[model samples]
Target: MYSLNKIIESTGELVSAKVFGKEQNRIFQDNFNSIWEKQRDSKLNIAVIGEFSSGKSTLINTLIHRNLLKTGFMVTTAAPAYLFNGREDYLYICAALADRKGYFIKIWEDGGKTVVEAYKETGPGLYKTLSKDGRSWIEYNEHLQFPEKLEDILAYMTTVEDAVKKMEKIEIFLPRNSLPEKMVIIDTPGVNPGKKDSSEHEMRTRKILEDIADTVLILFPADSVYTQTFEDFLNKNAARFMKHAVLMITMMDRVQEGEREEITEFAREKIKNKFHLKDPFLLSCSAGRAGKDEYWRSKFQKAEEQLMDNLRKKRERILAERTAGLLDNLLQEMNKTVDLKMEEITQKESRLREASVPNLRRTLDESYKEREWKIRAVKKQFKKSLSDDKEAMKVQAVAKVREELAKRKKRLDITKYVQNEKGLNAAVTESSQGMIGRAEYYCDLAGKKTLELKKELDEILIKYYGTIGAEAENEVQGRHAGSDVSVINSLIGNAITDVQKQENKNANSRDKWAAGIGIGVGLIVGGPLLAVGGLFLGIVGGDSLFVESSRTKVLNSFSAALPEIADKIEALLIENVNSAVTEQSNRLAAYKDQLEKRYQSVYDQIVGNIESQKAAVMKEKSEKEEIKEEIRRLKMNLEQWKRSR
Candidate 1:
C-alpha cells in the first residue's frame, strides 16, 4: 500500500504538471500541504462540548486524575482550556490583546529552577518579546513562580469574571502519565449556557468543534439525558459532528442504580433513531466519584480506553481515506481533460480533411460565437435569479429575527437593563449577538440555493455544448468508428468506476465537504452580527435616561426601539446575503470562463496543427499519443492505490 507521504508526493507532481487551472491548483496545493502537516504532527485534538453543568470539566479532571478545572452550578468555563501531556506540571496563560493576537505568560519549573516568561504576540500562535537592552529578544519574567501559585493563577485566569475577560485560552501541561502522548484535550464553554446570553461562548465552542477538533466528546448529564437544546445543536451540525463524535452520559452516579441500565438503553435508542447513528460509541460514567467508587472507576477506565483506541486507530484511517479521495478526484479530472483534448483534435482533423483553411476557420468561429452567446444568457438568468433570492431571503430573515426578538422580549428582565446604561447596552448587544447562529443558518441556506442554481446553469451548458467525456464520446463515435471510440470509452469507464468506488467507500466524506463550505459561509455571514451589537448600542445609548426612570419606562423604550432594531438587522442580513450571492456568482462566471478558455486553447492548437500538417503531422501525433499514455498510467496508478489499501 502507498503511504500518505507517497500519495501526497504523487499529487504534488500531478498538480505541477498543470492538470488544473492556476486557482484550482493553488487550492489543491494548500489542502495537500495542510494534510501533510497534520500527518507529520500526528497529534489528536479531542474537544469536549456540552451544556452548562454537563460534567465536561469533571470528565477531563477524572481523566487526568487532578482537580484542576473549576466546577460549579453556573457557567464556569469562560474560555477554551487545552490540556496536554508534559514532563513538568505547569501552564500558560494566553491573554487576548487584540483580534488573532495574544500574550503568552508561561509558568513552569524544573528541579530548583523556576521560569516565568511573557511573550508578546507577533503572529497567529507565534510570540516574541523585547530583550532587556530593548534591541533583541529574550525569554524571562519576574512576576510569579510555578507549583505553589499555579492553581490560584489558573482558577483566576480561567474562571474569574474579570480575569476571564482578558484571557484567550488556558494551556495546562501535566506529567507524561497524565494523558496520552500527542493528545490534547480541549474543554470548551457550554453551547447552551442556561439563562446567560453568552453568544461569544457558543460561537467559540462551535468554531472549535467545526474547525479544530479531530474527535469530539459530547457530554450529557445522566440525570437529564438529551435536552431540546442539545438536539437542536446536533441537528445544526449533524453532518460534521456525528461521524467524529462520542456520546457520553456523564454524572451517572446521580441516577438511581436500578434505572441506570434503562437510561443508558434509552439514550442508545435515541442516538440510533433520532440521530441516525447505527452503532454509536457511548459510555456512562460518574467522573465525580471515579476516584473513590469502584464501579465508577471501572466505567471511567472503559471510557479512557475507548479514547485511547480512537487516538491510536481512527486518526490514521481518516487521514488515509481523505488523501485517497483527493488523489482519486484529481486523477479523474485530469483524465477527463485529456479525453476532451483528444476529442477536439479528432474533430479538427476530420474538418481539415473535408474543408479549405478559410472555411474551417469560419466554422470554428461560428461555433465559438454560438456557445459564447448561450453562456452569456445562462449567466444573465443566473444573476437575476440570485437577486430575486436575495430579496426573498431578506424578508424571511427579518421575520425570523423579529420572532426570535419577540420571544426574548417576553423573557427579558427589565429591571436588569434599568439598573444602568451599561446594562442596557449589554442587553442589546447580547440580543444582537444571539442572532449570529440564525444568520449563519440563512447564509448556509443561500449557499446551497446558489449552488443549485449554478448546477442548473452547468446542465444547460452541457446540453448546448457537451464537453464532458461521455457526451463527447457519443458525438465522436457517431462521426468516426473503431480505435478512437474504444480509447474514449475506456477512459470514461475508468473514470466512472473510480467515482463509484469513492461513493461506496464513504458517502460521509461528501457531507463533510459540504459542511466545510457551510463553515466558510458562516464565518462570512456571522461577522456582521458581531458589529450588530455595537450598532444597536448607539441607537439605544440615548434612551438610557428613560430606562433608568422605571422598569416600565425601560420596557417601553426597548419596545419602541424594536422596529428600528429589526430594520437594522434586516438591512445587515440583506447585505450579507448579497455579498455571499455575488461571491458565488463570480465563482460560477470564473468557472465558465475557465471552461471556455480550455476549449479555445484546444481549438487554437488544432488549427495550428492542421495548418502545418505537411511539416508537423508526425510530431503532433506523437505528442497526442504521449498524452494518452500519461492518462492510462495515471488511471492504473490510482486503481492500484485504491486496491492496495
Candidate 2:
C-alpha cells in the first residue's frame, strides 16, 4: 500500500482520516454492493397491475402484505404502485421510468417535466416521516365535511405538480406501512365513466401506465363479466400491454358453486384464445373478504409470486450473458497487435523520461469539458426518470367520488361536487385543447430534440474523424529511432565484424589440418628409409620437430561456437517484438479501463436501484400477512356489527 493508504488505515480515527475512511467506505460499498446486486437485479420485469377494484391491491396485499394501497381510506387507489425485495428484481412506475429495450422513453414535451411530475407522483418514496396531522386529513374527516375535502383534492389533482412534495412536507401522514416489500403494483383507473369524469389525470396515468406495464392484470368483476369496454381497451392497446397480462376474475365469493371454474373456462375460451394467448392465468379473488373458499385465492397469489420470481431470474441471466459476451468480444480485440504494442509503450516511457506532454494533457482536459457537462445532464434526466409519479392523482379523483356516489341514495354534495365537476371539466378541456396542438407539439419536440442530439452527435462525429485524421497524420509522419533500421543495421553490422574472429579461428584450424596431413604422408612414405637413417644419426632433424608440434594441434575447434551464429537473426526478431509490445498493451488497457469506468456508474446505479426495489417488494411480501391480519380484524368487526344489528 502507499504511505497515504497506510496512514489512512492505521489512524482511521483521525479527523481527516475518519472523513476519508467514511468516504471510502461508502465508495467501496457502493461499488461492491452494486455489482453484487447486479445478478440479483437482472430478474424479469414483473409488473403487477390491475384495473380499479380488481384484486390488484389484494394480490399485492396477498403477495407482499404492505397495505400501501388505500381502499376506502386513501384519496385514491387507481394510482399505479410498485413493490419488490431489495436483494434483486425491479419495478419502474410507468410515469417515471419507461425504458424499453434499453432505450429511454423520451418526453415529447418541454424536457418531459410534466411527465416527470407524473412519474414522481406514482411512487412517492417510502412514506417515512412521522406524526403527520395531515395524514388523517388526507384520508378523511367526519367532523368537517368529506365531500368538500374530496372536492378540494380533486380540484388540485389535475395540475398538481407539487402534490408529492406537499404530501412529503406535511407532518401528519406517516406511512401506514413504511417498510414495504418490493414489487411494483400499478393500480389503475377502471374502465368507463368512473375515470372519464376526470380522465386527464387518468390519461396521463394511462400513458405512463401503458409504457411501464410489461404485464397487466386486467380485472373483471365476476358478477358483471367482461364488457365491450374491457375487450376494446385490451385490443386497442395490444401493443402497449399484452405479453404480460393475466386476466383476473374477481369476487369468487359473490358467485355460486362452480361459477368460478365456469367463468375461468369461459374467459379462456372467449378471451384468452381470441387474443391467441396460451395458458394465460385467470385468477378468481376478493380483495380482503374471500371467505371459506380460500383455495382459489391461495393459488392466485402463488401464481403471481412464481411469475414475478421467474421473470426476475430470467432477465438477470439474459443481461449477464449478453454483457459477458460483449466483454469477451472486446477482450478478443485486445489480443491483436502483439508485437507493435510493446514499441508504443517503450516510446511513451522514453517520452516520460524527458517531460510531461502538457499540450496533449491540456487538449484532453478541454475536450472533456463538454462531455462532463453532458454526462451530468444525462444523469439528471435519468434521475428524474427514476423518481416518483403520484399514482393516486391519476385515478383517485374519479374513483373516490364514484365509490362515494355508489354508496349514496341521495342527491350529490352540490357545493363541493360542482367545484369538483368544474375541475374535472377543466382538466378534460385543457387536455382536449391540446389534443390537436399537443400532437403537433409532440411531433415538433421529437424532431427538435432529435435534431439537437443529432447536432451533438455530429460534433462527436467531427471529433472522431478529426481524431482519426490527426492519428493518421501522426502515423504518416511518425519516426522511431529504434525502428530507424540504422540502429538495427548497426547491430547486424557487428555480425560481419564477428566474421573476422571466425575466419582467424578457421585459419588456425586449417593450418593444423594441413600440417597433420603432410606429416602423416612423410612418415608413411619414408618409414623404411627413416628407420635406417635414424639408427645412424640419432634422429637429429628439424623436420621431425615441425611434425611433432603439428601432431598435437586439432582442426574444427571453432565448430561448437559456430552454432550460435545461426540464432542471431531469430533473437533480433524477438527483441523487436518485445520493444513494441509494452506500448500497445498499455494503449489497449487504457481504452478498456476507460470504457469500463464510463459504464460502471450506470451499471452500479441500475443495480442499486433495482436491488432497492427488490427489498421494497420483499417488504411488501411480508406485509401481505399483515394486511391479511387487518382484513381479519375488519371481517370480525363486520360480523360483530351484524350480530348487534
Candidate 3:
C-alpha cells in the first residue's frame, strides 16, 4: 500500500548509509533520477537520431508539415533541439554572452498572425545576468516576424563554429495543431565521424538515445549503405532499442526509378540481418517537388502509427523496470547490513562462552573489567578509521572535481568563454568556483559519515555492554538485576532514539546528498555528451565568439589552473572534515563513560537484554521477508502485464 515516491525515499535513505562502488552508485543515482523525472513529467519523448546527411531534419519537417527546421545535404543541426506545442507560440533562449554572461530572452506572439508582429519582453526580470565569473549562466530570446525565422534561427543555433556560446539545447513552442500534447520530438546532432566529430556531440546524442528516448528513429540515406556509427549504436544498445526502433530509409527520391523497390527491400533485409528490425520505413522526399508532401505522408503513415503504439507500451515497461531496479538495490543493502549484524552477534556469543564465569559470585564485579580493554581498543580504532576515511574522501573529492573539469573541457567551447579579457577572467573564476563547490559537497558527505560512525560506535558499546551483563546475570540477579533494570533500559532507549534521529537527519538531507552524488556521475550511455555545468545562451555579440586556434590556449590555461584549484579545494575539505571529526570523536569518547556508569547498575540483567536484542533482530528480519515478498509480487504482476500487453 506504499506510494512509489515514499518507497523511493525510504530506499534512498536505507542504501545510502553504505558506500557502494563509485560506478554502481553513479548508475543507481542516474536511474533513480531518471525514474523520478519520468513520474513527474509524463511526456512521450521521441528522439530522432542518426548520422549526418541522413534526412533526420527532413523527416521532422515533413512530419510537422512545416519547414521550421533547416535541412541540407550536410550537417545542419549543430545542437539538440526540442519541438513541442504550447498555448501560444514563444521562443525561450539562453544566450551566451561575454565572460559567460548570458540572457534568458523570451519572444512571444501577442495575438498576432505573423512573427514580425510578436513582441520581445524581458518582463519582470525572470532571469539573471551572470557577471561575477563563478558559475555563470545565460539566457536570451526575441520575437520573430514569420515562421521562416524559426528555420533561420535554428540553422544558426545548430551550426558548430557559429553556434551560440553555451547554448546547450533549444526548445520550440508552437500551436497544438503542429505538435502532439503529450509528445516531444527531439532532433539530435549527427553522430557520424565525418560529420559531427566532436566527442561531446557524440556523447549527447548517445545520452538521449540511452536515457531519454522513448522511441528512436535511426535514419539512413536510402542511396547509401548504413554507416559504422549507426551500426555501432545498434550493436551497443540493441537489447532495449529493438523494442521501440524503426529504421528509416530516407532520401529515396535519389534512387533510380526502376531501382527504388529493389533498394527498399535490400535496405530492409540488411537491417533485419544486422540490426533485427524487419520492416524499415522507406522514405523519400523532394522538398519542392509537386505533391511531395502527400507522397511523404502516405509513405510514413503506417510506420508512424506503429511507432506511437510501441511507444506507449515501452513507457509502461520502463516505469516498471526502473522501480524494480531501485528495489533490487535497496534489498541488497538491507541484506548486507543484516548479515553483518548477525555475524557480529555470533562473534559476541562465542567470546562470552570462552570467558564464562568459573565462580558465579565473583564474576559480577570482574565483568566490567573484562570489556574495558576491548572498549578502549575499539575507541582507538574508531578514531584512526575516521582519520583514514577523511583522507580517502579528500582524495575522492579532488579527483572527482578534476574529472568534471576535464569533462567540461570536452563539452564546452572553452575558447568562446575566454575570447575577451572579461571572458577569460570569468571562465577562470567560474572554474575555481566549481572546484570549491565540489570540495564542499564531499566534505559534507564526510561529516554525515562521521554522524553514522558515531551511531555505529554507540551500537558497538551497547552490544559489548550486553555481553558483560550476560556473564554476570547468574551472580547479581537475585539482588541487583530487578532493581537496577531501569538504568540499562534508559541507555538502550537513548541508543534507539539516536538511531531514529540519524535516520531522520539523513532523509532530510537526501536532496543535498543526491546532488553531491550527481557531481561524480556522467551520462552513462555516451561519453561527455551533455554539458551539465553552467549553461550559457543568447545571440552572439560582445566578443564572446572565438576562432578554432584559441580553443587550445583556453583549454591549456584551464588544465593548468585545475590542479591548483583542486589542491585548494582538497585542503579546504580536509580542514572542514577534521573539525567535524574532532567534535564527533569527543562525543563518542564521552559515550564510553556513560556506558560504564549505566552498566554498573544492571550487572545481572545483561543475559535478558541480549535475549531481547536477538528477538528484536529476528522480528526485523521477518518483516524484511514480508517486504521482499511484496516486491516479488509486484515484479510478477509487472511481468504479467508486460506479457499480456
Candidate 4:
C-alpha cells in the first residue's frame, strides 16, 4: 500500500531529477509545492447562511456551548464571524477605512488580563500599526494597553448602521473541546436581510459560498419554514451550492411537539421537489433552548453528532482524492513532455536520412505559410465572435436593468415617502442604489462572459497550433515552442484583468451616479413643492392634500428617471464589454507574428545544424529509447499508487 505522503515524495523526487526541461521542472515544482501546502494544512470551512431573524447566531452559540454572540430581532450579526476552536477566547475585529484599507483590532485574555492590540492592513495578510503621530506605519506588536472587554469588542460586530457600514468581519476563538480539530464555522450575514442593502448582503454571502465554503448550512426557522423569500433565494442560488448543503430548521421549540415531524417532512419534500436535492441532510434543533431544556438538548446533541460524524468521515477522503487527482495530472503532463521530446528526436533522425537542407527549408517555408493563413482566419473569426457577443451583452444588460428597476418600483411603498423631504430622499437613494446594484450584477455577468470568450479562443488557438511542443506541422517547430504558447495564454489572462479593471471603474462611476441622482431628485421634487405654499398648507391643517401632492410628484419624477438610469447602466455595460473585446482582439492580432518568429527561429536552427544533427542521430536514438522506458515505469507507478488508495 502506498501512503499519500509517500506518493508526494516520489513525485517530487522524479520532478527534481531533471527528467523534464528547466521550464517544465519549475512549473511542476510550483504545483507540487502548492498541493503539499494544502495537504499539510487543509481545514473544512462550514458556512452558515440564512435570512434575517433566522436564528443563525443562536445556532452558532449553541454549537460552541457559549452565550457569546448577541441574538435578537434587530439583525445582531452584521458582519461575518469565523468561529474556530482554541484553548481560550479571542476576538479579532476588522474595520474598513475610507481609504479602502482595513483596521484590525485584536482582543484576547493573556495572564488573566484582557489584552488589546491594533493594526492596519498594509498589504494582503500583512498588518502594521501607526507611529505615535500616526504619520507612518511600523511593525509594532505590543499591546495598546486599553482596558477593553470582550463585550466592548463585540459591539463593533453589531447591526448599528454606522458600525455595520465600517465593519469588514470578525473572528472568534472559542474553547470547544468537542469540536472537530479541522473544522471552521463561518457565520455569514443574512442573505436576505430586511434592509435596503439586502442585495449587498446576498452578494457577500454568495461570494463566500462560491469561493471559500466547503460545506453550507442553510437555516430556516421551524415555525415559518420555507417562506416565499426562502424559496426565492433557493430558486435563484441554491443549485450552485446544494451539493454541499445541509438544510437546518432552527428554533424547533417554537413548533408544537406533534407538528414537528410533519413540518420536517413537508420542508424536506419541498426542497427535494423544487431543488432536486434527493435525501438532503436536514436537521431540526431548538438553539434558543440548547442547554436549558432536556428535550431540546437531546435534539441538539443528535444534530451535532450527525454533523460531526459526516465531517469526520468526509474530510480525509476528500483530501486523499484531491491529492491523488493532482498527482495523476502531474504524471500525465510529465509523460506528455517525454513523449514530445522522443517524437522530436525521431522526426529529426528520419528527416536527416531522407532530405537535403534546401528541400527541408522549402518544405518548412510552405508549411509556415499554410499555418499562418489558417491562424489569420481563426483570428478573424474570434474578433467577429467577440463583437457579436458584445452587442448581445449590451441588449441583455439593458433588459436586466429594466427588469430590476421594474421590480423595485412594484415593491415600493408610496405612502412611506409621502411624509417629508427626508422620506422622499430615502426613496430616491434606495432606487438609485438598487440601480447601481443591478448594474454591478450585469458587470459580473459580462466579466464571466469575457472569460468564456477567452477560453473558447484559447481552445481554438490550441486546436490549430497544437499544444506546447506539439505544433501543427513538425517541420517548423522547436522543443521550447511551449514558451510561445505561454505568451498566448498570458495575453488571454491580460484580457481578463482588463475586464475586471473596467468593471471596477464602472462601479465607481455608478456610485457617483447614485449619490448625484439621489440628491438631484430630492431637490427637484422637494424644492418647488415647499416653495409653492405646501408648508403653509400644513400650517393651515391642509397637510393631507399637500402630502398627497408631494407623493404624486415624487413618484412621477422617479418614474420618469427610471429609463434614463437604465440607459446609463446599459451604456456602461456596453463600454465595459467593448473594452474587453477590443483588448483581446488587439492582443490576438499579434499571434501570427509571434508564431512566425518562432517558426523562423526553429527553421534557422535546424538548417544551421543539419550536419551536426546527422552526426548525433544514432546516439540520440538510443537515449530516446531509454527515456521512453523511464516514462513507462513512472506511468505504471502512478497507476499503482492511485489504485492503492
Best by TM-score: 1
lDDT of 4 by residue, 190-290 (tens): 87776687887788777776556766788989878888877787677656557447788998899899999999999999988878886888888998897
lDDT of 2 at 638: 36
Give the candidates in order of TM-score, highest first.
Answer: 1, 3, 4, 2
Decoy 3 TM-score against native: 0.45
Q: Per-residue lDDT of 538-557 in model 1, one digit per residue for the tens?
A: 33432342223333433444
Candidate 4 collision pairs? none
By descending lDDT, how would the candidates be arranged?
1, 4, 3, 2
Candidate 4 residue runs with Cα over 4 Å from true position = 1-37, 87-103, 109-115, 120-149, 176-178, 231-240, 320-645
Write down the worst ten-residue block by lDDT for model 2. Answer: 100-109
**Per-residue lDDT tens digits of candidate 3, residues 1-645?**
544455555545544543445676677677677777886787878788877777788778766767767777765565787887666545332323222233433323345421322122245644442332212211132211112344564566666444534454567765665665577888887776454355666777878878777667777777685666677876875446654465666676677779877877776777777766656444444333323567755656655565556566666566666677677765675577567767777776776565444453333224333433332343344344444544443354344434433444321333223323343333333334433344344444334443444345344435544433212111111111123223323432343334334433433354344433343343442334321321111112111332222333334444444444444434544454444445444444444455445555554455566677778778778876765665566556555655665
Clashes of each: 0, 70, 24, 0
Query: What's the TM-score of each model vs. the native?
Result: 0.48, 0.30, 0.45, 0.43
Off by over 4 Å in 1: 12-18, 21-26, 89-102, 108-149, 160-162, 194-198, 325-645
RMSD of each: 40.9, 43.7, 40.0, 37.8
Better of 3 and 4 by lDDT: 4
Q: By summed lDDT, which 10 consecutive residues of candidate 1 come out lowest?
A: 472-481
The positional error of residue 60 in candidate 4, measured at the CA in angstroms, is 0.7
